[model samples]
Target: MRLGNVSLPVLASAVLCLGALISPAHAVPSQPWYLAAFDHVMRVLVNNEAPAVQMASGSAEQQNNVDPAYYSRVTKEAGTITLRGNVPSDGDLKVLQGVAAAIAPGASVVDRTRINPGVPNRDVWLAAMTFALRQMGKLNTGSASLRNAAITIEGVTNADDDFAVIQKKVREEAPKGLNLQVALKPHDVRPFVWLAQLQQGAVHLSGHVPSEQDKVIFGHAQVLFQNLTINSSMEVAKGEPKGWIEATKVSLEMLSLLYSGSVAISDKVVKIDGIYSSPAMVDLLKVYSKRLPEGFTLETSILEPVARAPAARAEDMSFAAHQARASYNP
Candidate 1:
């Protein structure tokens, strides 16, 4: 007999099997749509352990499979959108560039389509993208990857409320039997610093510093140099110097204004070795020297800032200023 123009026994059996498979799996008729990838991506969102803190860029690798399709969905929140490998027309990437552009007007969209055929887990491709998009929308940072129908979602977030929403949505959107991995880190907002050092013509700031103090130091430099290239090796850590915040600011200012010099501060010491910008700066430091925080001692040279003339033999402040220094024995 003719069944929808396909004709006979072959058509009947194919139709029967198709109906059976599609009932729970939602299999596609035109192409191989695997549920594994979709399930994997969905499961991670709702998974118990996948939550994070603050706002950091998330990443995912589309890999490891019996036969994996190289498709990835990345929502870089005001950064860029990246799509890689061969994605089905119905895949999440099909219209993702447009959608991403709409959401982040300046975000870049990169397409790297290298389709690998025979992937039966293609069905979940869109689900994976949608999941990533939702997570990114809430977390403002997230990534998704689908390989051999497996899904991975990752992000960094700070709000417990948002984490809860992500958890709920993940569970609700993800179907069962998914291979999902959720990687999220919690945000920590504590103040800390270790070493802040500036030297030569360039400012080299290393170690760690409290967020607030970091702002003052860097901010002051910005105002003075206008175009300063700071070699920053500092990080936000868990503690601060005995009285490091104010001392750090003064240290930075002294370095930025000097013709060429170095300033280094730690828990135990605040040492400066440089030529002062002017006699007034040296006086200024002497005036406020006592105002430096309690954690560190200040050790520096003193000299009148003389410029447009010559590079003096040594960077120490002028002898006249030194003789007048409060510590002078003579």
Candidate 2:
């Protein structure tokens, strides 16, 4: 007998020689070579079996209980939408085709998908696919992919305005119960600046912010100033300096400390100018600056209340002390 060109007896001899070279006791542990060969085989099987049994409990997943791998990808190029990947049924395939057609009415659909049964969370998967295709249609040439429960959309558009609009939509209208990531290249603006000004029960926010960092600022605003009206005119742009989000959060915190003031961050410099009724507020500002992350410089122009008559001065000082206490607690 032979395995292709190598004869069986030659193969057996090579295996025996190899086993002899690797044996723990130098090839021949016992009187008979057959016994040594048997020992080597048993040792190999036992060593491999032990690790498999040990790892079975900790690392092995039950095959029958595992969720089906569902994948769907959509790409648009040269006025054509190409749909690819696996769907649960023919109905889902048609639905995805229809979705693509609706998203880009003038473009043709190229279906290259397979029917894959047992797609877990069918409705959610379909919704995510539709959302992905719509976002993809907005781009001149772009791609969106759905693997299991995560969707990623990355591409470019013709105009900066269109890119900004798509980014806002993705951030605001992503499907629930799925992790959606967007990486639309944004136009870079040099000297990235953000401003928050507080006056008369309202805070006006303007300037530039990264796509995801907007939510952070909004969350902080919602909690810090429940009564104040938030008027934000922030635009989406890339090129945020180091420690951008951290510095922004710190700026928001310091802004909350003022009776009326503005926090303007341009590039890596944070300028905080406002009025505080207490001298203690100045000390508080200094402390906040100390905790600011590296690569940031803080400049403050906080003002104290104007001088008045002796009685008014005393009362103002008392109110300032109370304000300082409230700031610490709040």
Candidate 3:
């Protein structure tokens, strides 16, 4: 029978379910059983196996059987962070581990790494690599190596300026005879060595830059246009004029702060108009202007954008015959 909204049969079922939930289940591991479980988990690891144990004989972590070996391959491809080789110490492991964690958040550490003592001068390249990887924005994908007495570094950054800055830092910090090769994959919209000329009130951008660089610069230029008309005649060619990327970024930063003006960049000189607001911009651009491509000279001109004052609107009042006279007496 039913009791309120419940029945005697339902009450008995609930009690039986509670009894099952209260039941205890114990798990005891035997020596061989635990070993087999570990073997199954590490079956495919490259350096983890019998007879070839990790070589952590006499290092800081020797008591704990931890190796201080140094040879790691950390690469992130297709949204997967793959880690391999061996680490010298827990510090190195932690550094690479941190990189892996950032690349693959909420992802498992597929640790196939072994431990052994590292070689001489491992710290030099290790520190350099970690610094470079952290400096690179967006995608973290690159290989690093330290052999002989030379350090060779090759990596790509999103923006031209960033790649340049990081490259300088890496070279400066690295020991003498360090070989560095850094490049910008796709230069971000930095107002580098390009030209934004406001002549005849028409915006004209012209300079030799990578094909897509035109789009990035114009995108920033258009923002300044507001209601003003834009005449984009920027050319997209194969390569940029010498020192164009740096000049362009400086220009973008210039346009962002200034209201309206012309920024002209050549291998020889960088000129600007309507820059009375910030004379410092001229000095800043001199760095790029010095590296003019082959034959170039300083030039400056500006056709201040002509403001089109809106025409006064007279109410029609639904008139029948509205005579139109010559509006302009030019």
Of the candidates shown, which would achieve the greatest lDDT relative to the real structure?
A: 2
Off by over 4 Å in 1: 1-201, 211-216, 302-330
Candidate-wise lDDT, in order: 0.54, 0.75, 0.47
| Residue 21 Cα positional deviation in candidate 2, in Å, after optimal superposition | 91
Per-residue alpha-carbon lDDT of model 3 for 76-125, expressed as tens digits? 44445555665566677678768756645764545566655444445564
Q: Arrange candidates by lDDT, highest first: which order?
A: 2, 1, 3
lDDT of 2 by residue, 1-330 (tens): 555697756766776676667657654445546555545555545455645554564433433433566788989888889889878789888888888888888898998887776566677888899888888767767899999899999877543454467778876777888888887876567778888877667877878888767777988887888988988777777788988999988898888887776788888988876677466777787788887789899887676756566466555444543453343211
**Which portions of model 3 show Cα errors greater than 4 Å?**
1-71, 99-112, 135-140, 159-163, 169-184, 187-208, 211-330
**What is the alpha-carbon lDDT of model 2 when measured against the actual structure?**
0.75
What TM-score does structure 1 among the candidates reach? 0.35
Which candidate number has the best TM-score? 2
Instruction: Give the Cα error of residue 244 in candidate 3, in Å.
Output: 14
Cα TM-score per model: 0.35, 0.45, 0.34
RMSD of 1: 19.2
**Clashes (candidate 1):** 20
**Which regions of candidate 2 deviate over 4 angstroms?**
1-153, 157-159, 162-164, 167-185, 307-330
